[model samples]
Target: MANSSTNSTPGSSAREDAIRFYQIAAQRQPTPAETAAYKFIDPLAGFANCELKIFEKNSDLGGTWFENRYPGCACDIPIHNYQFTWAPYPHFPSFYTGAQDIYKYLKEVAEQHNLRKYIRLSHKIIGAKWIEERQKWQVQIVQTDGRELVVSDGETKDGEQGEPFIEECDIFINSSGAYNNWRWPTIPNREAYRGNMMHSASWPDVDYVTGRTVTLIGNGSSGIQILPAILDQADKIYVMLRSKTWVTPALANRFAGENGANKIYTDDEKENWSKDPEGYYAYRKEIENELNARFRLYLKDSQAQQMGKEATKKQMTARLSAKPELVNDLIPDFPVGCRRPTPGSGFLEALCSPKVEIIWGEIDTFNETGLKTASGKQVDSDTIICATGFNMGFVPRFSIVGLNGCDLREVWTQELPTAYLSVTVDKMPNYFVMMGPQSPLGHGSITGSIEMLTKYIRKLVSKLQTEAYASLVPREAATKAWLAHALKWMEKTVWVENCASSFKNGSSGRTVVSLHPGSRLHFFDLLEQPRYEDYEWTSLSSDPLSMFAWLADGFTAAESSAAADLSYYLVDAPHLKQRSRCAEEPTRATATGN
Candidate 1:
């Protein structure tokens, strides 16, 4: 959790009003993952006897939701199923959630769980090195006062920075997601352009380009979203594309009104939800089942994939039918699920607007005025927005030196970043990562994925505490075996067989580095319990004769402490009482003194 202040972008009156309306609508309910994290942490801390600290780089709780407040920014998944399993909201304003609503929901969770105290805002970890002797990670970090840290500055901290310090921990879990590192296109003279340039990740106030021409690059989620938001306001918009990307509609309605674009909650609906939590839970379950059923589309030649491809094409064609020229320009050559499917609500319609021009070609270079295409088309613009996508380097962006000076960046540079069950790396002992290599968001909501990862992390912590282990690192063979296993399954998935997309190493690459080979269900079961045998463990105690050293003072904690219940693990006291009575009864042999 970080600072809760929202950045108010003041420019066009219409845009400002839209933002204000979103703030009000999204303020009503807590997001699922927000509630989930709170519910899990409270129980986990007590059960495992662990201290939790949440380090946030931004001045906020919602990760992408906090940063990407661009126009038409919303989740494509059903809002009900896009959260934690235990925290369902009946009073959601839409089927999908917008960024503002997401941020508010997360804030609600932090406040409700009293998680702010444990959270260190503006504290960024610069590097972490494993100390073999101490069996801990020596983490180097820098702290700021909730100001955005510059990435390209070549220094860890920004202006007027504090001294660099170190924090030691037994286990280090990297939860900074893939979207945090933004990827810039390698266009010639990119910085030399004498115009306003911005990436969708750090979208500043567009007050200067209210009625000016703007050239937006890339066709990923950000590009699709930004186009629709600025269409009516901008004088002219040029959308550059290297390759066509599949665009589909949101799976469900997120708003309340008949329009279903921007609906608010009625007082009655809100009251009903507050009073009927169980009913709302059932509703959330139904949505979850619907989402889970769609996982079949990932299969290489499944009927679901075929139907999905056809449906997406049909929908996109109809959306751009008004301007038939864009139908072919936008339709992707690859399969629908090959890459992340962009669920654009008004994107196709926006493209049909008179002011929006769709330019199809690879951007060769960026001159002082604007960029020129591969086909020698020079498109002039007063502003350029790079929605080129992310670096997708699942490896830690900062320095992480492991055993024998094995830098994580160097290892990833040589080969594909590999992890054991997408949680633990082989050499990186006591280090766990969330949303690491092979953890895909293709199957379901990322919130669900996060909770699943958290459960795995909790189990790892419990094992470390209970076993009294100094260090536990996965066997090098185990990590290789897991990757090989994932590859076998990847061979059958559409992500590998279909035409290249971001799911692959590159748009035209063969290796699928992002997606998990198995379904979300499989991942949940696989991570539920770690294979202890697969890891080479180090015991804290060195004495060979003291095998049961953990059994301190020759007594269980319950037996030693009068306040503790010895039979706490026993289930059903009545059954135990019946067994005790039977035992107390005198047998014939015992009576005869045999």
Candidate 2:
């Protein structure tokens, strides 16, 4: 991290800085990205005198973790790499932490940080419009705390509906995750064939798969995780895949104890960590370093990429040797990291089992009994689970009217959703997005990207409050130019490779939107500071001299007391001290030698 300086504000009789900021919280176990937003905004509410309101559509935080509780649901990445660097959970059940464990961690984090008080659960911001006249955003929300009335069939009963309400805010932060919207497969007669249909996003607690014929659609993360888990329970399991995905055995299964499965921490190791927190941190650093070292795997045609691809293929082939017919259909032709690699520890083994069926074809339609493949084969399934992935439109489900009443969706439709550094936009003033289009999440730990973005947001918010700016939007040229630069960089990356991945843009699925072309470290270096000249700013006052009136007599709040640290100007002058010592060190050494 780079060195930074801070000065205490001179005590002012003027009212405290009161910026009304609203954050759309993701209703899942807080990912590293959401945690970054919380860390940033929490301090702003404290010393910056900003009012914070975190709107959660669900009953709690832990966006994905809280919602998706399917059997064998666990994180793909190592737990250490998945978490915030500042906040480490040394003691977890396994290396691949389960959904409940992650959710518990996030809940603990929120409570420990005192962020729960700022959260308004069961409230969703439905729509938002930028008010050009007032220079603030008018947000429309629907609160469903006590209003939702469900029938015996789990349908919304005919009762009082949740009404939409509006609130205005100076700054709006969209921390709602990229994959928040769960989508069903575009198969015909989905409504008609009503045999226990459920998406992985909203998996019920009941075990419908056990002793039943279960059909799973789409071979994404959810599908991969659910396969091995229900193999023993389900009498028959049919996994339908439209395309092949590379299942690498790089990550270990916590339970399997095979194919690079995570090593269990022995009692001695735990005792050692308990004795020394620094040692535990050092151990985590070792894991993090190993994760970062694999960045070269993303580089197309690199040696690391080739090695990874081969290793994955070998492991997958070995595991599926029992079923020679399915091996060819299971292994992908593309490189391992072309799409996100799913760990295939027990997954490959499960495919070889007689109880499982790997259907490698497009679906024709769904009947009242089961589904029919395009090859004229009917697969009988009592329960159809659509692990078909989320609706990654990249745009908000609710409408967002920007300048001149132009919808944000319309602008993105004109051209793919592009933003300045994937955060600030051209027309969207005083609006910021977390994990926006072209966010740096393709490689390495996503937490690093989140932390970098949070720091940038902190500076942007500080500038807005201190400079008395009515609003700030990136220059159209700057945003466009950055987008161009991003496209150029993406040309060399594997993300643009012809593969079906969530990183692709919207329904088109050709343009990559969710990932950065560069490494996480590169993004961190780039976003260390903002180029103020790149933004178009508006002042509250028309007079040029009065533009900085918010500065208030050129004195900070801490400067009111005479006994305050007057010589604090040199607090960040460590370099000067180092230089002085260096200058005298040679002289002293020469005299001592004589």
Indicate the residue-level lDDT of 399 in model 2: 72
**15-95 per-residue lDDT for model 2 (tens digits):** 443342333333222564356446655664332446666777666777777778888788888776677676677767666
Q: How many clashes does each candidate structure show, in the order listed?
A: 3, 17
Clash count, candidate 1: 3
lDDT of 1 by residue, 176-239 (tens): 6666467778888897789998887877865645889999897887788888888877899998
Worst 10 residues of 2 by lDDT: 1-10
lDDT of 2: 0.72
Error of 2 at 132 (Å): 2.1
What candidate 2 gets wrong by more than 4 Å, as runs, is 1-29, 32-38, 41-47, 145-160, 251-258, 264-271, 505-510, 556-558, 571-594
lDDT accuracy of residue 108 in candidate 1: 67
Error of 1 at 569 (Å): 6.2
Q: Which residue pairs collide, candidate 1? A: 94-254, 95-253, 95-254
Q: What is candidate 1's TM-score against the reference?
A: 0.86
TM-score of each: 0.86, 0.88
